[model samples]
Target: MIAVANLAWRSVLNRKNTALLTILTVAVSVVLLLGVERVRVQAKESFANTISGTDLIMGARSGNINLLLYSVFHIGNATNNVDWKTVKDIVGQPAVKWYIPISLGDSHRGFRVTGTTTTFFEQYRYGRKQLLSFQQGREFDALSDVVIGAEVARQLNYKLGDSIIIAHGLSDQSFTRHDDSPFEISGILNPTGTPIDRGVFVSLAAIDAIHEGWETGTKRATGAAFAKDYTNHEPTAVTAVFIGLKSRLQTFSLQRQINEYRFEPLSAIIPGLVLRELWSMMSVAEKTLLVVSGFVVFAGLLGMLSSLLTSLNERRREMAILRAVGARPHHIFLLLVSEAGLLTFCGIIVGILMLAVLLLFGVPILHAQYGLVVDVWHITEYELSMLAIVQAAGILIGCLPALSAYRQSLSDGMTIRV
Candidate 1:
């Protein structure tokens, strides 16, 4: 076997350019397969970490995923707003350590505007208990002050004290703009590689203040909170509430109480479970990428096989010479298979290195674009398994030309085949 490997190595060196190109082809396939899998993994991690350190998320009775989507991530609108009275009642409970009331239904340049208290910046966490920190200035102390997310601030070219008008709805093109009460940019939040980077936050009173005259989602009458001199501005309702329990064990009990409340329909969900549910919804897209990458790997192996087979006729003279020098048919076969397997192993190594380098450079860009955070040097079990499967498939492909060479060497002993 050692002699066969040595011969195989020398033969591959003879056609070094072809061998290197074949290896490069396989390496590209490996990079694609691993890259797709890595992105899928990072996406799940980023999504799951979208909200953390909250024991339970309470929202108006709706799908658990829906509540999670609209409340924590600001992806969708609430079907029904949770009454401020109900939220206050929940917060007053002894089981609740602290709570942040979040009011939604406004926008600034297509980014969802959230209404919450200063406690939100202190208590809300993401990506491993990471608290919200300001990149510039400080939290919104005034009712009409808006704290822009990193993405919002960067994309909108907003600086501290820049007054911007809030749109009446989520669209940037909304005609019903809140021109009556423009909000000054108070602070910009540091990026957390989560949905928080895209949010625009303000005091809950500001939400009510802007829509003060507008009753029931229409233009009506009352003193706008932003325009007033800090009087009795009551927020009638909030979209959802983020709850931190006094005791982690009471999470289920509090969640049950919130879910079974008689005053209004409400749902309390564990953030982790809701995240799992969200990932389940996205599994199809991940699987689709995996399947496509798998096909690319298969095609890459076929390209390797074609390279070996195409060189077969050319190597008949080499095979005949080996046979003349007392090499057996099986020896000839082993040489070809060994050469192919070595090239494949090298390609896999090259691919992994390429992926690591690509990730090292690309992770920040991905976070900047989609808020997806990934570990550059981490390898998961799925990635290892994928490499194993590809290596096994390559070995099988390597056997194809090996068997053909074996047959050719056996029949042409002591003679050259044209």
Candidate 2:
């Protein structure tokens, strides 16, 4: 057995280029497989952390998931805004714990401008009810002051005291720009990997004030252009409101109450349900990526198997000599199998390292583009399962060439086959 194993090692070394090429191919495929798994899992983690603590989300009558996307994640626009009266009534309900009224319909560049209050800093929580903290500066005090999310501040390169003008609508190409009533950057929030990290927040009164001037076609004080006296104007409505229930058990009850109320039609959605629905929509694409990664691994393993078989033919003489030295065919088989297993193990290791390196550089870019925060360093059970699959596949497919080599060794006996 020892002699046969030694011979197997030498035979593989003699054809190092073919073995190394097969290893590299399998390694690269494994790397891709691992990378896809990491991304899928981390994307889910990032999404799950996007909104937390809010027991229910109440908005104007519309798609439940749509409201969650636009209001919670800043993904799209709200078609309608619920009347401020509806928001006030909901907040006044006995079952309600706290509420953060969000008004959306404006943008600075592509980033969303969210009309909110200083209560947002205290009531809003995420990633397991973690309160938002500032990285620099202070919260907005004046109506014309704005607090920027981390991504907004970083991407726009805005700093404390930097003035910015808001557009009339929720678009990057808005024709009506509030160039006169520019707001100063008062605060910058720390990165939370949530929509807050990609949005600009101001008081609800500020949104109303800016649009009021647009409605009259003249500033309030000067009755000419930009004016600051519109703060006294009444707000018509808000896009949506995030309601935090006093108790977890009150969620469904409060949601039902809001939906059945005689007030204007509104939609009350459980954030968890909307999140699940959103994930269900993404499941198909995620599964497709996993399937593609599986195919890549299969192709790589087939290549490795073929390479091992081809090299076995060249090592027939070497195996014959070992058989002449009293090595059993089973020993020869075991030796070949071990070498193949070793190659697979090495391939998997290289693949993991490759995935780590790629994600280290890719996380920030992905966050900046899609506001999806991916934790690169964390490994989930799903990824470990993928590695286990790769290892098992390598061992299983690797035995085919070993079986062929054992057959050749038995037949060749004492004679060397060229």
Candidate 3:
């Protein structure tokens, strides 16, 4: 058996380039397959963790999905702004616990500007209901001061006391500019792994002040941006609001009350429900990507099989010599199987190393852009199962050529075909 194994090793080494190419192909495919599965699991985890502790999100009369997309995910624009009076009424309701109003529709460069109250720092929670913490400086205290999210601060390189010019519209390139009424960066927040990380938050009054000079140039001359008397100015409107109920049971009742309010047409969405619905909608795309990745792995195994079969023909003379030296047919079969097993195991190891490098670099970018926090080190159950399946498939490929060699050894009897 030892002599037969040595001959197998020699045979593989003789055609080193072909074997190496086969291993490389298998390694790359396994890397791609495992990479996709890792992302799928982590991305779902990140999405679920983005917003927590918040009971529901209330906004203008629109679909629940739409409210989540604009208010929580910052994906799309809010079509209408709800009346501040209605928001106040909701705040005063018996079923209500706490509510934070968020006004949107402005931007500083490409980042979305979120007009929210100071209560957000106290109420808004993310990733296991963790509270917001400031990396540097304090929360927005003055009307003209703003607190930028972590990604916004890092991308824009903002610091405490730095004044930033906010654009009039939500787009990166807006014809209108609030370059006149730039807000000073009062604070920069720590990473939250939520849409808030990509958002620029400020007091609702700050948004009003920036746009106060627009349409009517009356305030532009005197620079009396904020109305000294709060009630004297046109009643402010906010884009959307997040509501937290005192009890889970009060959620539906509060949503109904907000929807039936005569003040204006509004929609109230349960954040968890909306998130689930969003995931459901994306299920098809996710499944399709996974299928394609699986096929790629299957193709790699097929290529490995073909490479081994082709090499078996060239190594026939070596096999004949081994058989002449009293090596049994079963020993020849074991030798072939061992070579395939070694090549596959090596490929899988290389694939895992490649995946590790990819995840290490990918985490920061994913967190920055999409607020998806991925843990690079942890390998889930699915990944482990996939690794096992890859090795099993490699063994099966080996068996195909191993069986053919067994047949040849039986037919050769002693020293026969080369």
Off by over 4 Å in 2: 1-24, 171-175, 216-234, 353-380
**Candidate with the greatest TM-score versus the true structure:** 1
Stretches of model 1 off by over 4 angstroms after superposition:
171-175, 216-225, 231-234
Task: Find the candidate with the highest lDDT and give its number.
Answer: 1
lDDT of 1: 0.86
**Model 1 residue 210 lDDT score:** 78
lDDT, candidate 1, 132-201, per-residue tens: 8998999998787889989888887889999998888876554567876878988998888888888999
Query: If scored against the real structure, what TM-score would every candidate get?
Result: 0.94, 0.86, 0.83
Q: For candidate 3, write residues 344-391 as lDDT tens digits.
A: 877888888887888789878876566566666677787888888889
Off by over 4 Å in 3: 1-25, 171-175, 213-222, 226-235, 321-331, 353-373, 413-418
Best of the two (1, 2) by lDDT: 1
**Could you give the candidate ranking by TM-score, starting with the highest?**
1, 2, 3
lDDT of each: 0.86, 0.80, 0.80
Quality of model 3 by C-alpha lDDT: 0.80
